[model samples]
Target: MLIMNRKRMVEDKLDRLTKGQTAYAESRELIRLVKREIQNRQIPVLMDETDSGCWFIPQKNTTTPSDEQLAQM
Candidate 1:
């Protein structure tokens, strides 16, 4: 679980920016990247639980992602 203060990241990126307007743009990109990574990690847990037919109450419903996405995950 990677937790980050987006405001801080934005400020830092902005501080370092030589070409961009603000840090928010860079921060948004970083967030998108982080989100994609987290989602990638989650697929296996979801697959494993679903494959095993485990009664994981919190994750009652499971639907597999597409093959290409699954491969990337």
Candidate 2:
């Protein structure tokens, strides 16, 4: 439940970031919170910055499947 709440908070902040409705200064704390949560949870995602604001993005998976695995798929 706590994890879910944290996830929701991160999502809300990301939404505001994407909408470009909040000032960067105001969103700084929110960005910090999101970053802390990401680190604490070991989430497989990253935060990226843009001219307008910042947003979350899925991290690229580093592992590659072997030939047998690919064939099974």
Candidate 3:
């Protein structure tokens, strides 16, 4: 006959999953960028319309930005 501890098995799996999620966050970066432009439309207002685009980028590189680059912001 074989016996197993289900509680211990579940706890072990949870621990592994937590570690994996931490590793993924440390190894990935999510970037959001947006661009905008002005346009004229038929309305009482001077500028009634605008154009914009947003992007979400998921990068795998974990490289830290240089001090000079970071200083520019």
Where does model 3 exceed 4 Å of error?
A: 21-73
Instruction: Report clash pairs, candidate 1.
Output: none
RMSD versus native structure for model 2: 8.6
Clashing pairs in 2: none
lDDT of 1 by residue, 19-54 (tens): 322222224455454334435544222211233232
Go through the candidates in order and give each one's C-alpha lDDT.
0.39, 0.59, 0.28
Candidate 3 vs. truth: CA RMSD? 20.2
* Distance from true location, Cα of 67 in model 2, Å: 4.1
lDDT of 3 by residue, 1-73 (tens): 8754544433443343334321111111110101111112111112112233222222233578899989998
Flag the better candidate by lDDT, 1 or 2. 2
| Tens-digit lDDT string for candidate 2 (1-73) | 3334645667775555445433231256566777776577565665666655566664545899999999999
Colliding residue pairs in candidate 3? none
- Candidate that beats the other on TM-score, 2 or 3, i.e. the better one: 2
lDDT of 1 at 19: 31
List TM-scores for all candidates, in order.
Answer: 0.25, 0.51, 0.27
- After superposition, candidate 2 runs with Cα above 4 Å error: 1-8, 11-26, 50-52, 70-73
- Taking the candidates one at a time, how many backbone clashes does each contain? 0, 0, 0
Best first by TM-score, ranked? 2, 3, 1
